[model samples]
Target: MSMMVNSPLYPDDVDILAGALYAWCAERSIKLQSQEGLFAANVAISLYDAGYHTQDQLLGALHNYEFH
Candidate 1:
């Protein structure tokens, strides 16, 4: 599956990363629930905490998701 960054859903302070991740998941028809979102959120947070905010950075840093 291919991964790409997306725009923020809500306001500027909302979970921009989650929104991007969700968009990526949707593009691949990958369903994500609270649990899945949490996992991705964790990964997103990790990348953000590391001072990385690009979609490529997030996709590069995460490796546990099964994309079809």
Candidate 2:
């Protein structure tokens, strides 16, 4: 499942977040419908909400996240 774009984010932000989510999941071979995938989505959104706006920032934070 894709992350739901929140009202505060612009289209570019959405693109960055989505791409980050995709890369994060892809690296771990995680299905978006699974528990881990859900966690990843949540984490990505949370990070974005917290100010990791760029793809590199988001992905770096995500990669460092201990998702399991």
Candidate 3:
């Protein structure tokens, strides 16, 4: 398993991060439950706290998610 720091969903700013995560969840057709949204929000906050600062940085973390 990869660490969260290595996860591609990490975001630079809170809004964009949330947008990316929201879109990801939406693509999966995940229902926007309060609990789930809260969890995603927390993850975004943690990523921000960890010093991620660009879309490329976040995308690099997401490398594992890419389809070959």
Candidate 4:
């Protein structure tokens, strides 16, 4: 038997996203539920959807993004 899901990301892709989000928040002391944290999450997801699927690629893009 097999199961099908309708999502573009895989488990490892989620892991990289979580790890990058954690590292970014930890470095800046940003709460996971805070506004900036939400922004970071959005940016991460956007970058991932834009083909920044690798850990290094996502992290680098996240770091490069300014929080204005």
All candidates: TM-score: 0.47, 0.80, 0.47, 0.81
Assess candidate 4 and give its lDDT: 0.82
- For candidate 3, write residues 1-68 as lDDT tens digits: 22254445433365666656666557556564766655554554455446655545543333334322
Which is better, 2 or 3, measured by lDDT? 2
**Superposed model 3: Cα runs more than 4 Å off:** 1-12, 59-68
- Cα lDDT, all candidates: 0.56, 0.84, 0.51, 0.82
Question: Which pairs clash inside model 2?
Answer: none
**Models ranked on lDDT:** 2, 4, 1, 3
> What ranges in model 1 sit over 4 Å off?
1-16, 27-29, 64-68
Report the C-alpha lDDT of model 1 over 18-47, residue by residue, as the tens digit: 656777567656666655665666566656
Candidate 2 lDDT over 1-68, as tens digits, reads: 24564557778987998899898889888887889888888888888877898999999999887766
Identify the superior model by TM-score, candidate 1 or candidate 4. 4
Pairs that collide, model 1:
none
Best by lDDT: 2
Report the Cα lDDT for residue 3, model 1. 31
Worst 10 residues of 3 by lDDT: 59-68
Higher lDDT: candidate 2 or 4?
2
